[model samples]
Target chain A: MIRGIKLGLLVVCLAMAWGFPAQPAGANSDMPKPAARWVTADHSKFEALKQDFKSGPEVTKACLSCHNEAAGQVMKTIHWTWLSPDAPPEAKLGKGGLVVNNFCIAMPSNEPRCTSCHAGYGWKDKNFDFAKQENVDCLVCHEQTGTYKKFPAGAGNPASEPKKMGPETFLPPEWNKVAQSVARPSRDNCGTCHFYGGGGDMVKHGDLDSSMKNPDRNLDVHMDAKGANFACTRCHTTIAHKISGRAYKTPAAATRISLLKDDQISRITCESCHSETPHKVDVKLNDHTDKVACQTCHIPEFARKLPTKMRWDWATAGQRDAEGKPIKKKGPLGPPSYDGMKGDFTWQKDVRPVYQWFNGSITNVMAYTKIDPSQPVTLAKIDGDPGDANSRIYPFKLHTGRQPYDKSNNTMVVPKLFGPPGSGAYWSDYDWNKAISAGMAYVDLPYSGQYDFVETRYFFQTSHMVAPKDKAVSCQECHTVDSRLKGISGVYMPGRDYNRPLNYLGWGIAAAALLGVGLHGLGRAVARRKNGNHDHQA
Target chain B: MNGNGNGNKPLYLYTRFERFWHWAQAVLIIVLAVTGLEIHGSYTWLGFKRAVEVHNFCAWTWLVLYAFVLFWMATTGEWRQYIPTTKRLIDVALYYMVGIFQGKPHPVPKSERDKHNPLQRMTYLSISLILIPAQMATGFLYYFYNSWALWGWGAKLTLSTVAFIHTAGMFGFLAFLVVHVYMTTTGHTLTCHLKAMCTGWEEVGVPPKS
Candidate 1:
């Protein structure tokens, strides 16, 4: 107790030294306005929600009776279409297009399994109507009750009846209870799909995980349950159901320097709220705000609460036990290292991010882009350099994997991985030839019969899991010989890099000065002792 | 002569203002070097953030002291004490090297008009006119590195180049400090020059006539 008081006193002294007031920020500000009501009317009293809803679409149909144009606005959004509006025709930059990721390869033949995270329902195949109003799954974003979750392989459907799959049960939410629970999206509403992306929890974006749902200030200052308690939509800010905060419509480092000019720029900028000069006391660090993204220093590292998938190797998969049973091996923290259906995996906790200059635009190899078989293929390459004014240093999760590619065609081969028995799925039959042929034909992409696994590198920008300001990366971390930015080039960093010959010369001259002085001082002392001996007849 | 004292009367060697600036610079330079080296990643004493903060504060203080020192030198004509001259330079060098062992006095004796010998004059002058300014200039540039573009030299200068020059200046200071401190012992008595710096008075062979 005494130590705590002493520490508090010391902090107060330091604060005085730095010329900062000891009081908390915003302490003397005007009293905050009373909490505004999120919804104008009680949702339970609405007659539309009182019906016995049979399916997911029936709930959407009822929602449209009052919200009328919500499905149309949602249909035009990236969440519903899964496509980047700014992408070129050949790039096919999202799920709705020909994009392929190394985790699950292409989603062509795996639509039924992958579409569980889709914003709408009944999108099982190419023929799923995009114009249908009832297809929008409103509960996925609006449901306050935690029970409203979709089926894993039911094409975004919730079970109309109480159905048991494995140890979990899926049922249509009760008409009056869960339907009435609809409100603005909570962290759970977003975390249900995005947190579990790429098949399981903490797989793709290491910066996002289940921990953010109920975070303290240490995990996230803004989204802390005990602190600010911000919802995802606070920054994402929707307009007619279309979210405006797409990451790279411009570059990630794009600046809208003035508040008056904010409408001309994209929504994902921190400056939209914080302004050009955010620092009041240590304005020196504010100079770095232009070249260094807030996340690069604030986050320091990601995947803190859970181990994220760092490496995935499909080559070592499909090994069974002596009795022909599926084998599963445990890894660090009991996360799976090898699954007979998946592959060898590596996981990392509290992983320091790879720092890079990004202008917001990421370069990617399209589904049909031929690549060198000898080199590791680039699934998503961070685009930037030191000279670009639009670029700023950002942190990334560089996830690598080894997945199948056509050896002859020089293009990636999307294998059919998730289907029942005798469906020619790689997981079911473990036959590479049958799976590759079926998947390529379904996606309508030409592929050679022969295939081989190719190593792939993908860079996912980490902008979430912002740590408290006090926990920001220290200057010594980058100013030392060993730095997190060792791989980055083009700009000189002091202490990390130096002019070897000049540095050596500097130390040598200093050493020479010391030696010269030492010898001269010794000579004076020795000569004085000898002269005294002669004079005094010692 | 004794080890700590010379068999002579006391004579004034420095003024009150000169003593203050000299001691202040000595202390400031030491503080700056230690904290600056910590920032240079040569060693860790104070943490990096604290080291940077202290270094900047001391640097600003040194600049203020430097301005005062210059004002005093300019107004009082004390700057002439550091005027380089070649007269008796070789003799002063020889006195320290060989003649000092034979009990020869300093080739250039101290007086009201000549505060330094030929060798000391040149050395002190070079440090005041060149080495110190170089450190101050480079340090100024380093501190304002974030405002390089505003100064319109951001395109021409890189951080590595600035740091390289600043590091070289740091070495010069260290070399001068070692020899300068050691030379204090080579006086009429071991404490003669040391005591002169502290009390602004030196025990000379004969007391100055009033």
Candidate 2:
């Protein structure tokens, strides 16, 4: 029998060896060179670099002289227009200019302050032309000097000269020097705006923060500065100034071997490099790929290095101190739980992700999208179901907050958050009516004259801070009692739960067997003794 | 081995292969039950990861031993011993429940060709025919779950249903084990049946005249 079993195993092994593909010989021959050697064009030698630029457009005019098509390429992008290209036509509110958000409401009346993050100049009002190519700010992304600082209310232009405001003096960056030192976009360039998304550092997407700029392998294996040393562009590969890997739009699955290759790849998913079956050591782990998402196990948690805003209540924005000045409240963590400029806020650190099925499509609520004020509004709905073959479990950061809504119209209301003193902005006058009217008129929407706060939630998918394999969420984390997937339904999880009737029936049968065994034992003992006494008499 | 002392010799009931298979199966079952209960979340004597490892190891061991036992039984004609009969099934059940308390004789006697009584044959048949196959088939399916679609069975049986069936078979094994152990104590002496299993001989009462 042992020899037969050995022979069977040997035949199976031989068949597998004959059927499997052989490993390629030189897998690393095509590895990319270091980023320092990638740039061959010397920008400092160009005559355009010798110009003394007075404003952001002046620098852009110099840049366009040599790189003739650069501005045109940027002009067609959302970064320059602040308008989404594929927004539903009837909504007319897909762009950042008209969209309402839980934090700071709308960008219409607050363009001067909000456009500081925009990659162009002079978006101070509705009159800013979307067709203007000269307004594209190249230094915002390519500046290697680390000195280009766009101040709030600058309308995308860096401070040209030192200026003073409220108790703080702002020093201008050397624009000529910065323009001369342009190179590929570094982590600092992307981190400048994205890291401070919702008015502050680590305020919006929980998975992103300033810490990612130089993360160690312990924090993120892919972007580890000492190991893989991946820049943001490594994954969000760009072509013709169009960056890929936007979470708002993604593919159902990744289908490419190389991220840099121009192929049919899921630009936003981990599967792009890992493939559908990444666990080569354990086939059992790979089997979970159809149902469990890579991030659900790999990410483990978000906001690892900083506390992110978990909740925001705009209704509490008007609170003031004894001196009638807006007051700030700090939570147990170092970050403020409430800022007079914003509202009541709650922050969290090292937060576990919420799991859900996503088919990589989202239907977001537009600015004028009719909403019901009676219940918490889903600002964006991830489209998928448990039954969808294309859908896989994904991790999400569910950001909850309250934003202004028109009480009479039963729709979301965008409020002007920043303006000059006496301009009737919420930050300046603490008046909701004036702010709402100004913001609503800017977007060509009607204000109902009466407004209140309505609870809102935004589902932000986590796609970064992937930990090492040893740090991934363990099997027991989702399989044991009161597991992380506790509230998740539509699928059965062994060890986490069992059929109650089946459990009772098992116990009942065992009890009956024990009862019969005990009674039979007693009867047999008595019968044997009685038979023995009869045998003696015979 | 002590007999009834009515001039009847002890019968050679079990063979060497049967004795080895029985003891090996008993040890494997005990290991399986210990780890199985832990994996089922009944208690935490062994941690979940370790419990799963031990359970899988024992399951594979039992599977290999089971295959060998099947071959042994087939070649030795011991497979016919477990063929169930309804002839005295009710009488044996009655003896256990009520008639035994009134000191009535046993319903059926053991023999070389038909070693098991009616109740023992039916119980063993159910275990070998229904429960063992259920566990083995379901266990194999789970172990190779990733290849379910490759086998063109994607929509047929879900992982949950397969797992439930395996757990149900485990419950059956547990009940059988308890009853089997208790029935061993029903021999002429306290240790009589155990010694018979170990020595391949069962001491019985006086034989009737031919």
Candidate 3:
């Protein structure tokens, strides 16, 4: 019996020691690849493409002849108007005209340089008309050729002349060739402006960068070149030239419109393709969708390929080299951490996104809006609460910075940063007073004599570059001690911080059991021997 | 009684139902402990996704089986065997602590009417009355977490507290399991208790006190 029992114990010990090997979870199913990149039609054969367009307006005229209503459709979008119809009448002028950002502050004073990213042409000042159809640049988003270039101080027009743009001789794009080579928007077309947001690459939106042009499956499974090869329109789902989703400004919730409702259909959400119950196999994961956004898990970290700007301090600007040129200092990551043209900046790569309960409503800071100088202004506030049914735990990139603001008026100020010499620009003259004064005069706003760089923070919603399911964040990532959800409040998670008294009780019981077992076994052995009972086990 | 190869008789101390309940409970407890510890972040060998599934399934199985066993024990009058008495309880404690090492006989006798010793009876009673019920209640609360807002007390209770109670219960179960396995080897033969659990019979001797 003893030998049998020992053998059984040995077998059990050996089996346990070998351990149960874990099977890898998640499927590697692929979505159907997109069609080849070649355009179906040759636009150069058309008579409209035969002429040498002298300016952007002449190119727009040729485009309007065939696609007459295309300019009208573009005008209605926030990309053109820069103002949402939902905004109050008091501040509905336009995002470019009134909205103040923490990065480079307001845009009113620096339209020539700022409008380089705008879809329309010649928005240099308040005098620029929002109703002009000819000013719309059709080739910006549709140009099939990669030669469409928008230079600084040209408003929205390509540099057609060999003009000197701050130390570089800028060559203009061939309008005749570019106008004839128009095709459907590609990654290059969208990335021209979006990738270089906040004046440089990977500065404004942490999740977006030039690396997304031909990403691998490891970088972004959805847009992988070797896999899905999805275009921007694949998810954005544009209709009548109006892109479905809006960033910087997002809706509180996706207002559904179908046979189920009569409300006007709006932007596309993650639920549009994934469906409300995304996790078909796991019902528990589906239940989590109500209170957790898909991006929170699927996209574990943002800025995976490159370092993104985390913070900037304009207070440290105006540093000059020995030759009196703007000083530039490179960080360990190869990006300029300190530039005399801007200020001090901090950058990070593979950053874990901050989680918050956001309902998607954003409150943007406008130029004329009053601000308390005592605290860092929230350039864009993500509004939501834990109790709100519409709210979900979403991932965000919080960019903290400092920018020039009107000390006397308690409002954010616009500074001229780029221009020719003697232009009263900060970069040209290094005079904050003159640059701000010129900027305020252009926007028809009063500028106080006293100016200072105030601290500010902007919140960016992370919505793209999703990885594969297997690459998604594991459960133990956020469910352990000192976990990712450490800063998040009002939610109870197991193994990551527990209640105190209950923990003590658990240990106490185990200790008592050990003592009881040892004493009982010893007493039983002693009592049996004292009774002259030679009977023994084992 | 039946005569063994060693000339010692084996008495039918446990019924088939009792033996079945004991073995079933032991298997269920072992399954629960392995999966439960994995769920508590002890190790990630099973992977959290699979561990949760196994733990929840075994918990339900154990709960349902225990309910059925309780009914069977009550109807068969076997529940009376677990009732504790002060008579010879101190003697049994002393016998285990010191008397057994000095070659003294066991204070209590093993019979059809009373198979468990006084210490075993009290321990089993505590486990069944206090520990098992507490764990079951906490486990039930955890399972129905979504419906917490519907009940007044449940609404006031935080999920962390519920999780804490459940974890505490798991530890108690672990301690009980360790002692139970060790005690099984202390019978007249090394495998005597295990054999009785399977065959419904145990080797016995005349009680010295009797």
Candidate 4:
């Protein structure tokens, strides 16, 4: 017993000398610094965040005290302006611009509801100052507290106090607490606007949804919360808050990033880290990189967890019951199939993506663009073909819809969809002519006073929800008859495409040779059998 | 020369080296045909990727064998043997077509200097000198399709045309194989020609030279 005690004492001494493996920096440390090595300073200690604030703009005023040039920098970004200057001027291509889409139409006469998701405050009209530094909502993106909630119809303003509207009670944030928690944008920050783009989760982009916030490895290998756990700022590496990536108007080409990341050409492409030849040298798949984008093979299907809105028919909207109340019908999936205010909707889960030859650019059909009434309007056209050197096969979610169009003008009409009782909104008055007239007057466009629902097709690129490498599509999926790439033209795939006449001729010759040889052998056998006694060996 | 089978002297129609290459060429051609057809998606036996690798390998082996054959033919003055002859060509054709069924003697038979008959010389010459060489050229062009842009005229060349020519060549080879195999049976006896190919000696029937 004495010897055992002596040995235990020696072991304790050795352990003490070496120091036990570090208890997590917070669990056992006497005093842990708030900021990590990467963060230069913690915002909680800043004097500007110590004061209580009245509004989100007041909080932005405080943030600007230290980050002086931040608002000026943000005003130039697409997120702040919602206008793509890179697009053709006549197209008026962006959210704030006069571009009409099948979903919610345009935002001109519907600012109160639509501007609630805007990065800045009080953008209720065309006169909302785009240059005001205090209007920037800094807490919406950077606040780690996650307490910020914009009022549903408050024009990008969070309530100063608890304000109940409909079913949701918008709670006012503790301004000091939210302001103190400022940092870089997280996945939740970007998801606030992007995930709920078409007014609900998984409504706009099939690849983006609330399920992506903390996905597992099976859903996305890169952004898996438990694995890589990469923040949005990781690949969308921003400099001066410009957020170096594509815009509403797609870029015509992708810039290759240097391996060291010092080249300043960070384009949020798969090639940013994975070069053009991602597969190892001599691999057959490596050769396909030139013709096929990473997303085409990596993301087999999207909306894995949630069913996304696939189609909407605005023509079937505005049905009321005997009591004059709005009607709603539940879909096969969880969401409502028909809402009296909106229309019929089709939702799909685990949807296979459509493919296109994309050079990164697209032709957006704007409100001013002329249309043919006989056919479905192509809202956006992917601009590339197999022959284009910049082109590669990319995957997309092709959403089809029917919305208001002008029969007289041969152009799409933006309907006033969201407003109060006297505002002549389509949802309120249930009148297409009144809503179209109000909407056309707001955008300063002439109303033809003729309205009809025309079918439209819109395409969104599938870049996220990338399944694991093991779940990628097999070779035979695209290389066989009735293949996934069946409708694609301008290139010949071997097993999928065969020259029927040449094949028939080649096979015919081989068959004929066999048949001829067999017949000749049979004839010689018959001749020998008939002349039984003749010795004709020579 | 007139009565080859009746010659009494024990004759050797095939040399040892010639028999080796002929049998080797037959096996190589069969391998190339099967793998080449598989690569064309005729059927999925051996799969696509394996078929291409194997086809290329067999084609290279055939080319090497043909190169040695060319060198041997040049040095030994045996290139003259493949020269086409109209001498009794029609008679030989008629013999195979009509007379052979009636048990008439062969119009042209294997001899010391002319193992290949008039018809054999024409068929073998065209196949070895024309068809196979054309096939090899197209096969190589198809294999190096990715490098087409490097060549001035190659950019204008379509893969479909190259592949079609190569596929047609495969059919030609297969047809040749069927007819050539059947013709081996039309000798003096069923097994005599096969025996000569194997042992390099022909047993000239019914007499012994003195």
TM-score per candidate for chain A alone:
0.88, 0.88, 0.85, 0.91
Kindly indicate the candidate among 3 and 4 with the higher DockQ. Answer: 3
Error of 3 at A412 (Å): 3.9
lDDT of 1 by residue, A79-120 (tens): 888777567645567776667677877777787788889999
Query: Candidate 1, after superposition: displacement of residue B71 in Å?
Result: 1.2
Give the poorly placed runs of model 2, Cα more than 4 Å off.
Answer: A1-35, A93-98, A164-169, A247-267, A519-538, B1-8, B33-50, B102-105, B203-210
Candidate 1 displacement at residue A316 in angstroms: 1.2
DockQ of 2: 0.29
Per-prediction fnat? 0.42, 0.31, 0.47, 0.31
User: 1 or 2: which has the higher TM-score?
Assistant: 1
Model 2 residue A67 lDDT score: 85
Q: What digit string (tens of lDDT, one per residue) describes model 2 on residues A75-117?
A: 7666776665555435443446456667666677788888889
| Model 1 pairs whose backbones collide | A251-A359, A252-A360
Q: Which candidate model has the greater TM-score, 1 or 4? A: 1
Select the stronger candidate by DockQ from 1 and 4: 1
**What TM-score does structure 3 among the candidates reach?**
0.82
Clashing pairs in 4: none
CAPRI rating of model 4: acceptable
Residue A127, candidate 3: alpha-carbon lDDT = 78
